[model samples]
Target chain A: MGFEMFAVFPGCTLEKYSSELKEPLIKILKYLGIEWIDLGGRCCGMPLLLSGDSESFREVIRSNTDYLRNVVVITSCAGCFRVFREYYSGFMVKHLSQFILDLGFSSFPHKVDLRAVYHDPCELIRCRVAEEPRELLRRIPGLSLSEFKLNRESSTCCGGGGLVKAIFPSLAVEVAYEKILRELPQDVDAIVSSCPFCYLNFKDAASIYSLNIKVYDIIHILGMALGVL
Target chain B: MFDNVFQTYKLRLYEAMDNSFIRAALRRAVDSFRINRDKALKRYSDVEDKRLRLIEVKKHVLSNLESYVKQTMESIESNNSYAYYAKSINDALKIIDEVIGSGKMIVKSKSITSEELNLNYNLKLKGNIVYETDLGELIIQLLDSKPMHILSPAIHVPKEKVAELFSKISGENLPPDIPKLTMFARSFLRDKFFKADIGISGANAIVANTGSIVLIENEGNARYVSNTPPKYVVIAGLEKILPTLIDATILVEVVSRYASYYMPSFVSIISGPSKTGDIEKTQVLGVHGPREVHIILLDNGRSEVARDPLFSQALYCIRCGACLYECPIYQLVAGNFGYTYFGGVGAIWTAFIDRELHYASLIAFTCTLCGRCKVKCPMNIDTPEMILKLRESIHSIKLIPEPIRQIIENVKKYGSPYGLTNRFL
Candidate 1:
């Protein structure tokens, strides 16, 4: 398969707390014979758009689209995938899950026995980029997936959207906590989601609520299974 | 605009979130509505097709709004009913005052259009004895609370609260039995229905071609309000017009499916007045219902909304609370999210009507832009899109909050909202 080409957009979260998600991502891509280029430090302009700064949002969108106009840009963040696909139409954008699902990994470096419920990020669901993450999660051996009663398009928010975390952090956390109490599977070992924002919110809930469940980005779980984390 | 309202919004949001009774009621109501809506839609082979047809009809009428308004007025006049156009809230109230003309006993059915004008408050301030007839609306009126939902105005109130409220009103310590409480309200309102000189109602759809107004409800109070009084008045937004009775019927079906997931128990189609041709084939206006019918078409910034290409889709809303059932934020906040109208649709509508953008901003900002409202809407009104547009418009006027401005600054300076320097090499 001639899958040796794509520009990778590792969004801001991957540069910070989710940096661990990258090494395994790279290893898995390499194992699948995919060649990727780092698109460098740039915001996808979602925060600006959500926060009522249209001029800067425009500038960011213009610059990002101008840079990636010719190449297929693969994003590790679901928000980046949404902004690029929906707003900046100059380039073809894909979530790394979609790219990986297309490339097809032969084996995970190690098997992980994980019983997880997938938390669909609003951006992923709205952009219809939801199933790729679930399919990728299913690729892991000995991992069983259960669903929240409200899943896919109707999934409860992680309370990170529309800059709520920046504006009303407590309210955001409260919403996240409620989602956990109401929707989360009682017997699940972990909650896995694809969006970094959702991952952060869920992580906050897990800590503040002192729940004994691990919250992982699908990439983090894949990284553990690939023995690269 | 954004800052002043944010504090109150936070407090109200906290209160709403803390109230377990309201939360449980909202949860159950939304779930039941969703399930009922789904099951109801299963009867049709193509709900989307019907929805698209309705959207087309609405768009056509909105595009030709001026001519349609004129036509509707002419039809009402020819049918021996009076029609007047009110350009603003004060203008609508003035028309209502003129029509009622010092009438003391007044009864009103559930009308969100009336709520937008604050008609009841204005009338009460003017010393008219006005009673709300619809059960949910009457409950909210008794509690002196704003409506919490479009269809179910008192959805946030628990049975115990209603029982206590009724006990105080009727001087009887009523149990929380729903039927008994309903019986109390029915008897309480029955006298007002007959004793009133004027009945006020809202039109769901004004059929321009036939000069008929359609009112759909489950409570049957609209029928009493429109029929029992000597004088009847309909206060409706100008956008509530359809080309013909057939279109109105289609709208009734669409609204029923979306509002509560079943056909409403009552539909009142009043053409002009209570007319009788039974005597000698010579028509007389008053027989059983109101002798004089007056329909007031209130503009209230609808012309501007119609002129807007992006936002005019908002007027296509049939007041079906389907989006409310689908909305996560509205599920939490109930009607506290808006000033008059609630949820995303209310935010856009209030932005157009309310000058204070403070209340509008607070209402609009809480939306997460999840696009679920659009998915749930039969007309597919892009509520989240309209809200973001409202934000952008208010931003252009420099009304954005300080925190949001700082967040934008942080994103600009540090490529992330967290304001951290790049840690990845």
Candidate 2:
């Protein structure tokens, strides 16, 4: 993928988090022998669209859709999945984990028996992308997963999104605290997440707040199984 | 405050607050708010529409607040109620202090504005007997804690812990039952309401046409707080003002149904102090609903908000707090969403209004940059854009952790932050 991958950012991945997962993501894809063409998309426009700026949102999406043809769009953010699956229905969308499992499961030459719980992103479940990640995770041998009590239809939001973090930090933290308090297992060694957004946000939650909890990206874990290191 | 703001960000706040006693107190208080709010929302079918209409009304009100507040103040005076328009939090706080002498008993109902000013602690510091009458607020008060949720102040507290708090605070053997907890708070607050000299509340909507301050709540306390006291004061955010009574009426329909509530048991519309055209058309203001009503119209940076183009758009928020429940990061870490403000949008506002207030640059950085917060926001505040601006500001200052900084620098040089080479595996 070229710089066009930057468009998924709207403005975020562009400026603040531009470097996140770039190397790990690129290395994994290359190891999996997957070809990811940029297709020259604009900013995912999720941010602009979410703000009720439909005009800017439409303009950005129109530009993105124009460049795509018969290629599966892979991204690690559940937010991007929501926009691609529903907003731009023309392109096939999958979180990077699913793409890796589909194209590179047999390419794996190592084994991983890591036990962890998966933190579900609200969008993946709320917007109905729930089962795909689990199906993909199952394809990897010796991957033990735990279930959240409030999973799928009953899943609660992570509270990291919206302007809550910006506008009302106290209330937003309260919500995140609730989810982690309820969903995270008491004895789990690590938490795995498919969405990069959820992955990083939860890392902050676990490392800074809980301190004892551990977290990892699904792609990062899968890289071990594929002997891509 | 600036010296210590970043300290809170770097250290784990929740673990610090996670003493066994404090944890128990939070668990007890949060459960009842959830149950009551759930029951309220269950009674309504068109909650989504009501939420949308409410969002639209808030946007319109903020857009036209200058004219609406003038009209509202005129109507309030025409009806014998007084409005003290103040341009800042201090201005409003001073107006309240000047009117209500210190050390008097003050009864407060549910209002996020009260929390925003840290009003209870401020009042208590001045030797006033302050009683928070709202059930959730009462529980929090007993614990000497700040509110955890806007609509549900004690949402972080589960029920069993509330029972434990009740057993200790009230000297009663209350079990962990939710109903018992409600009645327990009610039993204690009922006496406070009648004997209290002052009543303080927050308005859901201040109708300019009718000069009415609308109090919508599932509990009956807001009614008693407004109606029973001799002196009633409303400390309302400027965004609460709406154009017409009919517009507000549509909003009452929405607010009652979808405060993430079923239908509020009580929707109090107090146009003015309880007055009567007794004996020959002469008006008398004394009766019920307070002999005197004072509406303190607070700016607290709202006017500056109304003036700006880039950030002013978010001033349209109606404080529904629904967006928190729909968030991803908010769901984790329970109450630690990340300090004074948690979650995505709060971080942006914290950064914009005063970045010093929320030093967690992590709160802004941790957002997966997902637009979900905007979708969940009733006003649809563009959180992603705001977060980008916040992160840009934070990164520019190099407040980023050293490891993350090295990552970004690597990405700058090698086109990948992980410091990986171009070779496959």
Highest-DockQ candidate = 1
lDDT of 2 at B131: 91
Model 2 bad stretches (over 4 Å): A1-229, B1-4, B14-43, B125-127, B158-181, B253-259, B332-335, B338-342, B348-362, B366-372, B394-425
Interface RMSD of each: 2.5, 9.8
lDDT of candidate 1 over B1-425, digit per residue (tens): 45656877778887887789878998889778978888888875466677789999999999999999999999999989999999999899898888886648999999999988888988887778899999999999999999998889999999999999999988989999999999999999999999999999999999999999999988889999999999999999989999999999888888888775568899889988988888799999888889999999999999889989999998999998888877777777788877888887788887896555876776767777777888788898988789888888877777776678786777787776657666223
Judging by lDDT against the true structure, name the best candidate.
1
Against the reference, the lDDT scores of all candidates come to 0.83, 0.65
Docking class of 1: medium
TM-score of each: 0.95, 0.69
Error of 2 at B100 (Å): 1.2
Model 2 chain A: ten consecutive residues of lowest lDDT: A5-14
How does the DockQ of candidate 2 come out? 0.13
Off by over 4 Å in 1: A1-5, A18-35, B423-425
Give per-residue CA lDDT, model 2, range A24-125, as digits (tens). Answer: 566666775545664322346555443334554566677667654455777776666777777885657767766665554553466677677776776676
